[model samples]
Target chain A: MPILWLFLIVLAIAAAGYVIGRSRAVASVGGDHRKMHSLASFYGSNVAIKVFVPAFLFTIAWLLVQPIVVNATVSDMIPEAAIADNSSRGLVMAEVRRIADGLDSAVAAGGMSADFARTPQTDLDDVTQRIKDAGGVVTSDITAPVLNAAQRYRAMNGTGNFIMSGLAILIALGGAWWGIRESHADFRARNTVETSIRALLIGAASIAILTTLGIVLSLIFNTIEFFRLYPAADFFFGTNWAPSFSGRGGSSDLGVLPLLWGTFYISIVALAVAVPIGLFAAIYLSEYASKRVRSVAKPLLEVLAGIPTIVYGLFALLTVGPLLLEIFGKDGLGWMQAGTAVMTAGLVMGIMLIPFVSSLSDDIINAVPQALRDGSYGLGATQSETIKQVVLPAALPGIVGAILLAASRAIGETMIVVLGAGAAARLSLNPFEAMTTVTAKIVSQLTGDADFASPEALVAFALGMTLFVITLALNVLALYIVRKYREQYE
Target chain B: MMKDNADERIGVDAMDIKFAAKDVQVYYADNHAIKDVSVDILDKTVTAFIGPSGCGKSTFLRSLNRMNDTIPICRVEGDIRLDGQDINAPEVDPVQLRAKVGMVFQKPNPFPKSIYDNVAYGPRIHGLARGKAELDEIVEKSLRRAAIWDEVKDRLDAAGTGLSGGQQQRLCIARAVATEPEVLLMDEPCSALDPIATAQVEELIDELRQSYSVIIVTHSMQQAARVSQKTAFFHLGNLVEYGDTTDIFTNPRDTRTESYITGRIG
Candidate 1:
C-alpha cells in the first residue's frame, strides 16, 4: 500500500475513534454533558490523539528501519568475488538497491513477471534491457550474484512493507479500542489531551533545535576531515590562498588570512558607508519625521531590507560597479582596473545593509525612554543637543549591537561579493583592488569538477565552519549587548 | 524664623512679578485642558499649584516654561510674559526661554551619564562656562545648592542613574539649577520619593526660593501648605482661588477651596 493511503486509513480509524469515544462518554453521563469530567470535544480529541499519534509514530519508525535492514540482508547475499577492486561495498549496495527498484518497476509495467523478477534464472542482458525499457535507471549489466541480491532485496522490502502496514493498522485499532473503553465520565480526558499537546509542542521545538545541532555537527566533522588533509597552521595563518585544482597531490596553499582580511576590509568599508547613513536615516525617521511621513517612509525604508540580496548583487554588478568604474577605473583615475572590486561589493552591500542597521537602530532609539528626552529638553537643550547628549547615549549600547549584527551580515554576504567583488583573494589595502571573502571562496571551492576527498573541495566545509564561528560570535555579542541594555532600562 | 519671614513677605507689593499670565487658555487637540487661567508668579518665592488629578494644574505649570510646545496637539492662547516680555512672541525662542526657566519633572529622571556630566550638561549646552574649570565650578556650585554635593561629591564619575530615588531627583534639580535659570518649574518633583526624601526635597525647594522663582504642582494639599508661600487652587481646569498659603489653608475665600482643603470635595 502507498504511504498516503496508509496515512488516510489511520486517519479514518482515528475519526471513528473520535465519534465512538464522544458518544460513549456522553452515554456514560446518561447524555448529560454537565456530569462529564470534560467537554465532549475533549473526549473526542483524546481518542483521536491516542489513535493517531502512536500508530503514525510506529509507521514512520518502520519506514525508516525497513530499508536499512533490507539493505544489510541483501548485500550479505552478494559474494565477495563479485565485488570489483577500487569500488566500495557501499557503492555496490547502491547499485543493488537501484537494480532492485528497476526490477520492481519493470514488473509493475508488465515488461517482466513477478515470478521472473523473484527467480534467479532470468538472462542478465534481457532483464537489464527490460528494466531500462521500463524507464528505470541501470548503471551496468546485472551479474548473476547481483541479480540474486536484487531479487532478495525486493522480496525483503515487499514483506517489510506488508508487515509495517499490518502493524500500523493493528496499533491504530488497538489504540482506538483502548480509548473508547476509557471513555467514561470519570476519565480526565482534557488533562490527558492537554499533556499530549504540550509534548507535541515540545517535540516541534526540539526538532528545530536538534536540526541546527545536526548541521553544526556535520560541519565540525567535515572541517576536522579537511584539517586532517591540510595543515591546521597553514590553513589558519598562511597568507596565500591559491588552491591548485590540477589534482589532489599537488601542493595547494589554503591560507585563510587573506580571505579573512578581505572579509574584514570589505566589512569595514560597508560599515563605514552604512553606519552614518543608516543612523542618520533612523534618527530622522524616529525623531524628526511626522506621523504622516513616518507611516509611509518607515515601511518604504524597510522595503530596502525586503529586497533579496541576490537582486542587490545584480544591481551591484550591472549598475553600481560600472558607475564606480567610470569614476575610478583605468580610463579615469587609474585607481581601479575593473568594475568588480572590493569597493564595488562593499558599497552595494552597505546599501543592502542600510535598512538592517536603520530599522534596528530606529527601534533602539525609539526604545530610549521618553523621560530621558524630557529631562534633556527640560534643561533648555535644543532638540539636536538633547538627542546628541541624552537620547543617543541611552540608546548607544543597543545601536552598537545593531551595528555589530549588520557587520556579521556584511561578513556573511556571498552573492553581492561574488558578483561585485572578483574571485581573487588578495591581501591589499586598496578598496578598488579585487579581493574575495570566505563565503565567496566557499562557493567557488565547492561548485566545480573538484574531487570531494581533496583538500581544495573539503576546504569549503572548513571555510563554512570558520564563517559560522565568526558570525555566531558576532550574534552572541550582539545579543549580549542588547540584553544588557534591556536590563539597564527595565 | 523662615516661616515668619515668608509670612511677612506675603502680600507685599515690593516683590517683583516674575511671570504674569493674562487669560491663558490651553487646548490639547480640542480638549480644553486649561481654561482662562491667570495668575502673577512673584520672584524669590515658592508658589504651589494644587489640584486633583487631571484638574489641569500641571498643564498650567507646563505652560509657564512653554513645555507644552513639545506636544504637537497642544495650543496655548493669550499672553504669558516673563520679566515683562511676552515669552509667546515669535521672536522668543523656546530653547533660550527654557534656559531661563528650567524644570524638574514629577518623576526623578537623571540622564544616563556620570554625576559630574549630568550637572555639566545644562551649562555646557547654554555656554555658561568658558572652560572646564568654570564648568566644574558651576557643577559643584549647582550640586551644592541642590544639597546633593556632599552625597555625590566623592563619586562624581558614577552614573547619575545609580542614585536613589530622592538623590536622583535632587540631581535633576542640580542639573536644572546648573543653567542658573531665573525661574524653576518643578512638577511634583518629590512625588516619587518617600517621606524622608520628600522632606529633603521640600527643604531644598525652600532654599531654592532664595535664588529662583519656583512654581510647583502638587497633589498633596499638605505639601502645598508645607512648601509654598503663595498657593493657587485649581478645580476643574479653573483657578478657584489664589492667596497666601496660610490664608488658603486657614481661611479660604471660595467654597470649593474650603471644601478641597477640608477634604469635603476634590
Candidate 2:
C-alpha cells in the first residue's frame, strides 16, 4: 500500500477512537459533565493520541528498515561474477531495484504477464523489450542472476509492506480498545493529554537543533577528509588559489588566503558604502521624519531588503559594473580594466544591505527611551545636538551589532560576486581589480563534473566550514555586545 | 473675585513679582486643559500648585518654560512675561527660554552618562563655562546646590543612572540648576520617591527659594503647606483659590476650596 493511504487509514482509526472514547466517558458519567475529571474534548484527544502515536511510529520505523534489509538479502543473492567490470555491488543493486519497479509497472501496463515476471528462467531480451514498451528505462541487457535477484527483491518488498500494514492496523485497534477501557469518569485524561503535548513540543524544538548539528558534523567530516589529502598549513597560509583537476595529473595549490582577503576587502568596501548611508537614513526616518512620511518611507525602504539577491546580482552585472567602469576605466582615470571588479560587486552588495542595516538600526534608535531625549532637550540642547550626544551614544552598541550582522551577510554573499566580481583569486589592494570570494569559489568548485573525492571538490566543504565558523563567531560577538548594552538600561 | 491688598495678604511687597501672567489658556488638541488662569508669582519664594490628578497643574507649570511646545497637539495662549519681557513673543527663542527656566520632571531621569557629565551637560550646552576648570567648578557648585554633593562626591565618574532613587532625583535637580536659570519648574518631583527622598527634595526646594523663583506642582496638600509660601488650588482645570498657604489651609475662600481642604471633596 502507498504510504499516504496507510496514513489516511491510521487517521480514520484515530478519529473513530476519538468519537467512541468521548461517548463512552460521557455515558459512564451518566450525562453529567461535573462528575468527569476532564472535559469531553480532553478524553477524545487522549484516545486519539494513544491510537495515533505508537502506530505511526511503528509504521515509520518499518518503512525505514524494510528497504535496507531487503536490499541486503537481494544483493547477497547475486554472485560476484554477475557484476559488470565497470559496476560495483551498489550500482548493480540500484539497477535491480529499478528493474523490479519497472517489472511492476510493466505488469500493470499489460506489456508483460505477472507469471512471466515472477519466473527467473525467462528470456532476458523479451523481458527487457516488455519493460521498454511499458516506458521503463533499461540501460542494458539483463543477466540470469541479476533477473533472479530483481525478482526476489520485489517479492520480499511486497511481503514486507503487506505485513507492515497488517501490524500497524493491529496496533491501532489495540490502542483503541485500551483507550475505551480507560474511558471512565475518574480517568485523568487531561493530564495525559497535557504531558503528550509537552513531549511533542520538545520533539519539535530538538529537531531544529539536531539538524544544525547534523550539518556541522557533515561539514567537519568532509573538512577532515580534505585535510588528509592537502596540508592544513598550505591551505591556511598559502596565497595562491589554483585547483587542477585530478584527470590532469597536475598539482593544485588550494590556499584560502586570497579568498579570505577578497572576502574582507569586498566586505569593507560594502560596509563603507552601507554604514553611513544606512545609519543616516535610519536616523532621519526615526527622528526627523513626520508620522505620515515615516509610515510610507519605512516600508518603502524595507522593500530593498525584499528584492532577491540574484536580482541584485543582475543589476550589478548589467548596470552598476558598467557605470563604475565608465568612470574609472582606461578612458577615464585608467584604474579599472573591466566591468567586473571588487568595487562593482561591493557597491551593489552595499545597496542590497541598505534596508537590512537601516531597518535594524532604526528600531534600535527608536528603542532609546524618550526620557533621555527629554532630558537633553530640557537642558536647552538643539535637536541635532541631542541626537548626536545622547541618542547616538545610547544606541551605539546596538548599531555596531547591526553593522557586524551586515558584514557577515556581505562576506557570505555569492551571486553578486559571481556576476560582478570576476573569478580571479589574487591578493591586491586595488578596489578596481577583479577578485573572487570564498563563497563564489565554493559554488564554482561544487558544480560541474568534478569527482567528489578529489581535493578540488572536497575543498568546498572546507571553505564552507571556515565561513561558518567566522560568521558564527561574528554572530556570537554581536549578541554579546547587544546583551551587555541592554543590561545598562534595564 | 475680590482683590485684597498684596501686603496685607502675605506681608510681601507687590514689586517682587517675577512672573506675571494674564488670562492664560492651554489646549491639547480640541480639549481645553487650563482655562483663564491669572496669577503673579514672587521671586525668591516657593509657590505650590495643588490639584487632583489631570487638573492641569502640570500643564500650567510646563507652559512656563514652553515645554508644552514639544507636544504636537498642545497650544498655549495669552500673555506671560518674565522680567517684564513677553516670553511668547516671536523674537524670543524657546531654547534660550528653556535655559532661563529649567525643569525637573515627576520621575527621576538622569542621562546615561557619568555623574560629572550629567551635571556638566546644561552648562556645556549653554556655554556657561569657558574652560574645563570652570566647567568642573560649575558642576561642583550645581551638585552642592542640589544637596547631593556629599553622597556622590567620591564617585563623580560613576554612571548617573547607578544612583539610588533619591540620588538620581537630586542629580536631575543638579542638571537643571547647571544652566543657572532664574526660575525652576518642578513637576511633582517627589512623586516617584519614598518619604525620606521626598523630605530631602522638599528641603532642597526650600533652600532653592533663596536665589530663584520656584514653582512646584503637588498632589499632597500637606506637602504644599510644608514647602510653599503661597499656594494655588486647582479643581477641574480651574484655579479655585490662590492665597498664602496658611490662609488657604485654614480660612474658607470658595465653598469648593473649603470642601477640598477639609477632605470633603477633591
Candidate 3:
C-alpha cells in the first residue's frame, strides 16, 4: 500500500476509537460525565492518541528499515564476476535496484506479465526492451545475474511491505481495544494524556537538539577524513591558500591562516562600525526618545534586520562598493584595484548587523530596571549622567553579549563576503584590499565538479567545522554573559 | 472640632519652612490625581504623609521635588516654592533642584556598582568633591550619616547589590545624602524592608532630620506617629488635615482623619 493510504487507514481506525472510547466512558458512568475522572473529550483523545501514535511510529520504522533489509539481501545475489571493471559493488547494487524498479513499472504498465517478470527463463533482451518501451531508465542491456537480482529484490520488497502493513494495522486495532477496555469512570485519562503530551513535546524538542548533534557529527567525520588526506599542521599553520584543482590526486595548499585573518579583519571592521552606532541607537531609543518617537523608530530600525543578507550583498556589490571605489580606487586615490574588497563587504555587513545589535541591546538596556533610573535621577543625576553612571554599567554585560553574538553572525555570514569581499585568500592589513572568509571559501570549494576524495573538495567540511566551532564558542560566551547579568537584577 | 491651630502647636517662629506648596493640583492624563492641596514642610523636622494607597500622598511628596516630571502624562499646576524660590520657574533647572532635594525610593535601588561607587555617584555628578581624596571623604561621611558605616566600612569595594536588604536601603540613603541636599523625600522607604530594617531606617530618618528637612510618605499610621514631628493625612486626593503629629493623633479634628487613624475606614 502507498504510505499515504496506510496513514489514512490508521487515522480512520483512530477516529473510530475516539467515538467508541468516549461512549464507553459515558456508558460506564451511566451517561453522566460528571461521574468520570476527566472530561469526555479527554477520554476520547486518550484512545485516539494511543491508537495513532504507536502505529504511526511503527509504520515509519518499517518504511525506513525495509529498504535497507531488502537491499542487503538482494545485493548478495549478484556474484563478483558480474561486476564491471573500475566500478564498485555498491554501484552494481544501485543498478540492480534501478532494474528492479523498472521491472515493477513495466509489469504495472502492462508491457510485461507478472509471471514473466518473476520467471528466470524469460529472455533477458526481451525484458530489457520491454522495460525501455515502458520508459524506464536503464544504464545498459540487462544481464542474467542483474535480472535475477532485480527479481529477488522486487519480491522481498513486496513481501516486506505487505508484512509491514498487516502488522501496523494489527497494532492499531490492539491499542484501540486496550484503550476502550480501560475506559472506565475511575480511569485517569487526563493524567495519561498529559504524560503523552509531555512526551510528544519532549520528542519535538529533542529533534532540534539531535539535528544539531547530527550536523556536528557529520562535520567531524568529514573533517577527520580531510585531515587524513592532508597534513593537519599544514592546513592549520600554512600561510598559503592555493587549492590546486588537478583531479583526484593533486597537491593543494589548504592553509587556514589567511582565511582566519580575513575573517577576523572583516569582523573587527564590522564590529567597529556596528557596536558604537548600535549602542548609541539603543540608548537613544531606550532612554531619550519620547514614547511616540520610540514606537515608530524602534520598528523602523528593526526593519534593517529583516532585509536578506543576499540583498545586502547585492547592495554592497552594486552600490556601496562603487561609491567607495570612486573615492579610494584607481579613479581617485589609486589605493584600491576594484570595487569588491574587504572594506566593501565589511561596511555592508556592518549595516546588516546594526539592527541585530541595536535591537538586542535596546532590549537589554530597557531591561535595566526603571527603579535604577529613578534612583539615579532622585540623586540629582541628569539623564545622560544617570545613563552613563548607572544604566550602561548595569547593562554592560548584556550589551557585550549582544556585540559578541553579532560578531559570530559576521563571522558566519557568506553572501555579503562572497559578493562584496572578492574571493582572494590574501593576508593583507589594508582595508581596501580584497579578501575571503571561511564561509565564502567553503562555498567556492564545494560548488564545482571536483573529486570528493581530494583535499580540495573535502577541505570545505574542515572549513565549515572551523566556522561552526568559532560561532558556537562565541554563542556560548554570549549566553554566559547574558545569563550572569540577568542573575544580577533578578 | 479643634480650631485650625497649626501655628500654635509648633511655635511657628522657631521653625523655618523648607518647602511650601500652594494650591498644587496634579493631573495624570485625564485623571485628577491630586486636588487642590497645600502644606508647609518645615526645616530640620521629620514630616510624614500618611494615607491609603493611591490617596495622592506619594504624588504630593513627589511634586515637592518635581520628580513627577519624569512621568510623561503627569502635570502639576500652581506653585511649589523651595525656600521662597519658585522651583517650577523656567530658569530653575530640575537637575539642580533635585540636587537640593534628594529622594529615597520605596524599594532599595542600589546601583549595580561597588559600595563606594554607589555612594560616590551623586557627589561625582554634582562636582561636590574637589578630588579623589575629598570624594572618598564625602563617601565615608555619607555612609556614616546613613548609619551603615560600621557594617560596610570593610567591604567598600564590594557590589552594593550583594548587600542585605537593610544594608542596601541604608546604602541608598547614603547615596541620597552624598549630594548634601537641604530636603530629603522618602517614598515609603521602609515598605520593602523587615521590621528590623524598618527600625534601622526609621532611626536613620530621625538622625537625618538634624541636617535636612525629611518628608516621608508611609502607609503605617504607627510609623507616622513614631518617626514624624509633623503629620499630614490625605484622603481621596485631598489633604484632610496638617498639623503637629501629636495633635493629629491625640486630639479630635476632622472626622475623616479620626476614621482613618482609628482604622474605621482607610
Model 1 clash pairs are none
Tens-digit per-residue lDDT, B140-196, candidate 2: 999999999999999999999999999999999999999998999999999999999
TM per candidate comes to 0.93, 0.95, 0.95
Candidate 2 wrongly placed segments (more than 4 Å):
A110-116, A246-250, B1-13, B264-266
Order the candidates by DockQ, highest first: 3, 1, 2
CAPRI grade, predicted model 3: high
The weakest ten consecutive residues by lDDT in model 2 chain A span: A242-251
Q: Write the per-residue lDDT of candidate 1 for residues A1-490, one digit (tens) a residue.
A: 7888899999999999999999999999899999999999889888999899999999989888988888888878888988989777888888888999899889999998989888886578999999999999998778888888888888898888889999999999999998999999999999999999899999999999999999999999999999999999999999999998885744899999999999998899899999999999999999999989999999999999999889999998999999999999877898999989999999999998899999999999999888888888888988999999998999999999999999999999999999999999999999999999999999999997868899999999999999999999999999998888676765
Q: Model 3 over residues A134-212: C-alpha lDDT tens digits?
A: 8888998788898899889989988888888889999999989989988888999999999999999999999999999
DockQ of each: 0.76, 0.69, 0.83
Is model 1 an incorrect, acceptable, medium or high docking prediction? medium
- How would the candidate models be sorted by TM-score, starting from the highest? 2, 3, 1
In angstroms and one decimal each, the interface RMSD of every candidate reads 0.7, 1.0, 0.5
lDDT of 2 by residue, A144-230 (tens): 888899999989998999999989989988998888888988999999999999999999999999999999999999999999888
Candidate 3: where is the Cα deviation over 4 Å? A25-35, A40-43, A80-92, A120-135, A247-250, B1-9, B12-15
Clashes of each: 0, 0, 0
